[model samples]
Target: MCRWLVYAGSAIRPEELLYKVDHSLIDQSMHSKLGATTLNGDGFGMGWYDGPRPPGLFRGIGPAWGDRNLRELSEHLESPLFFAHIRASTGSPVQESNCHPFRYRDWLWMHNGEIHGFHQIKRELVLAIEPELFPHLEGSTDSELMFYLALSYGLRDDPIAGVARMVGHVERVAAAHDIRDPMQMTIATSDGEHVWVFRYSTQHQSRSLFYSRRIEALRELYPDNANFRRLSEQTRIIVSEPLGDLPGAWHEVPESACGLVDPGRDFLQDFHPEPV
Candidate 1:
């Protein structure tokens, strides 16, 4: 449904992740090799944090590959954590508010899949959101709705458990409507500190997802590679696909798994379908 990239590590300009690579996220906006669509030109957005709270975000209803403003902004904005998403609107309108990398308080989120039967299931899902949070929803997107659903289920404290519970609710409700496999999601969320990513679908086959190997290991593997040399040891990235063709540099996240990049730990764990 979309193409996205998440970067967390040493402070650096966003272009290093969004545009510099041979097959960067911006490139994917025009020629995505692994997404449902090769050209995700509906819209694009970027979010970055350099403070105590969540990051600042810039979004527009323009294709990522040809946006002069995005190119200009990425060159100057630097942060230790950031997210970029190129959209291929499955149901939502291609408007600024409907762009990916939605935000709330000190948190940012983006998704690369759809809520099947969203139009039919939208009411039930919306009614489940916390009233306070519901009022804050600025867009009519299944992705943004999913974010608030996680928040209502306690995302601010325990993202993993909260998201699982939210998914559980979706499954239960969708079943009532005779909707099978109601979800396909590759989501990334962060609070300017710890970042969590999930890859799951009700049918057990989800979209593509990968995370980069540690920068140190990459440096050793390609000692003469300037790209790997410029990165910090903790530099990490999770994407809808490998950013480049560097062999052994990326690993596919298992289906029904969650990847976490905390301040000190970077690892993934199998995700069970049951409510957590």
Candidate 2:
């Protein structure tokens, strides 16, 4: 399992979400309160859109807190949309290529749970990826494979539909091998503007995911809170857990749900289970 966050809405430094909160993503890497593992020190990665040419990515096979390069880049880069991930490798090697927030063209993706029994279904999943996109495969983690699967299913054209189909494909294959809970995931994917996040599991239980309340609502809840004061109304975040403990600041995404966050609008709806 891993911990990750997607920040969008306001064009601000990625560090605002990666480091400013009391329990920032960097903090979670070392002291996560809700993850299966408190210390996600295997590796870390951050991706953010700047001007053009997809997004800038910085990854290291080091603890997030101890990575100076990550600190310098996060403090300097500003993007309306960004993704940060702290890894706790399940079965993959703890290398830079195995870090989260893998990218392809202008798209970026990250996941927080495992494809249950990945070792058993790895071959089938690999064979299912789009042959053209297969050449882009550069890592061995299940997370990276899942990204290619979504791309194969049409991520560039219809992310939601493509992901839904990818999960369905996984379900169909995993079931053939008698694997239960073929997936457990809280995934985020983006194309530099819109972000689609999903929280789902084959077993009806998934990792925690929460979205920040609208900035206005948060301001109302804590009128004097400096953090809320600094954020724009469009500022939104989807995380593996809340960054802070402010009341009325965060809401849990329901089990088997997908959250879509555009510039000024955000929506969360039920996610139908995918058959494997």
Candidate 3:
């Protein structure tokens, strides 16, 4: 239902992907090729790690394509690891607080897709969040609630398992309410260093997710491409959709999969939801 991207590796201006690319995130906000909706103009957000400070965040309740501040900030803000999301509300109100790339302490998170019948199941899921975390729930979107649910299940300690538990917990509640196939998500979260991504849903048809091929390999394919010149061999991007159609440059993540992208190495593995 939305478009987003995460970058890890060498520090670079976000505009390179948000505005400069052929089908950039900004472009996708209005002309999404893979998302369920064509217009992701409800709101937008950006989160990035800069130095030792907590990650910087900027969110706005406006079309990303026309946001003057988003455009201006993207041009100057450079980060080794960053996340950008443009939203198309499933049912949540269009508000700044509902925009993605949600932050908690040093962590940042964003999501695409929704929990079917979220309104019917919201109260139950919200009640399950850790009492302390419940106060930090700043938005009404299912995505933010999912973030806290994962944290309640232990995201700060074990991100993958925490999210798995969160998903499992949600499905359990949904089943009680007679809402079948309640989960659909492609999520990305980071803690100023490593980034973790997941693609999964109860119905087995998750949304699009792709990662950039190794910069070393990309260089071999496009020696004259200046974009690859500065990126480190480990530089990786996990996106809702491809930034361009460069052959061998993008690889679709398998269904029900989870992966990690760090400064060292990146890998993907099968993912499944288990009982909490």
Candidate 4:
């Protein structure tokens, strides 16, 4: 299990959400309330789009709380869309490459759950990735594998459907191996434009995921709060937990649901895996 957040809205320094919030991602790394593991100190990573080019990434094989570079970068860099993740390895190695916010071309992705019995299905899943995409696989974590799997299934064309196919493939293979509960994930992906998030599991109990309420409403409630005023009305954030204790500031994403955040509107709908 892990903790992660996706911010898709106004351009602001990452620290505003990664550190300034009461229950920020950095805080969750040391004291997560809903994750399977409380301390996600294995590693951390962030990906953000600053221009028309591909997203820039910063990853480290160290606890996010004590990483001075992460702290400095977060305070200086600003982006309209970004992702940050703190890892609590399920079984993968604690290395820089295994960090989340995996990237390819202009896309970025991260996850907060695992592929149940990953060791049993690793070979099969790896073989399923397309040959061209296989060479780009940079880490052994199931999270990165899921990213490539989605890419092979057309992530660049239709992200939601590609991920659905990826999950379907994993579930089908796990079923053949007689693994009862084969998947658990709260995943986020983006290509510098629309952001898509999915919460699902084969057992019907997925990891925690929440999206922030409309910034306009929050600003009205806290008129004097500079943080709310700094953000634009279209600002949208999805995280593993609420960033603050403010009532109605966050909404838990429903089980087996997919959330899409575009320019000025956000949409939530049922998500079901489709076999490849």
Better of 2 and 3 by TM-score: 3
Give the alpha carbon lDDT tens digit for every residue of 1-276 in model 1.
899989988888999878888898988989999999999999999999998865798999989888999999999978889999999999678899999899998999999999999899899899999998988899999999999999999899999888998898888888999998999999999988889999999999999999998888998899999877877888889999998789999999999999789766777898765553
Residue 107, model 2: lDDT of: 96
| TM-scores, one per candidate | 0.97, 0.97, 0.98, 0.98
Task: Give the poorly placed runs of model 1, Cα more than 4 Å off.
Answer: none
Q: How far is candidate 3 from the true structure (C-alpha RMSD, Å)?
A: 0.8
Whole-model Cα lDDT per candidate? Answer: 0.90, 0.89, 0.93, 0.93
lDDT of 3: 0.93
Tens-digit lDDT track of model 4 for 1-276: 899999988899999989998999999999999999999999999999998999999999999999999999999998999999999999889988999899999999999888888999899999999999998998899999999999999889998899999999999999999998888999999989889999999988999999988988999888888988888889999999888789878889999999889976779999999997
Give one clash count per candidate, in the order shown. Answer: 0, 3, 0, 0
Q: Tell me the spans in candidate 2 whose CA falls farther than 4 Å from its real position.
A: 273-276
Give the number of colliding residue pairs in candidate 3: 0
Give the lowest summed-lDDT range of ten residues in model 3. Answer: 260-269
Better of 1 and 4 by TM-score: 4
RMSD of each: 1.1, 1.3, 0.8, 0.8
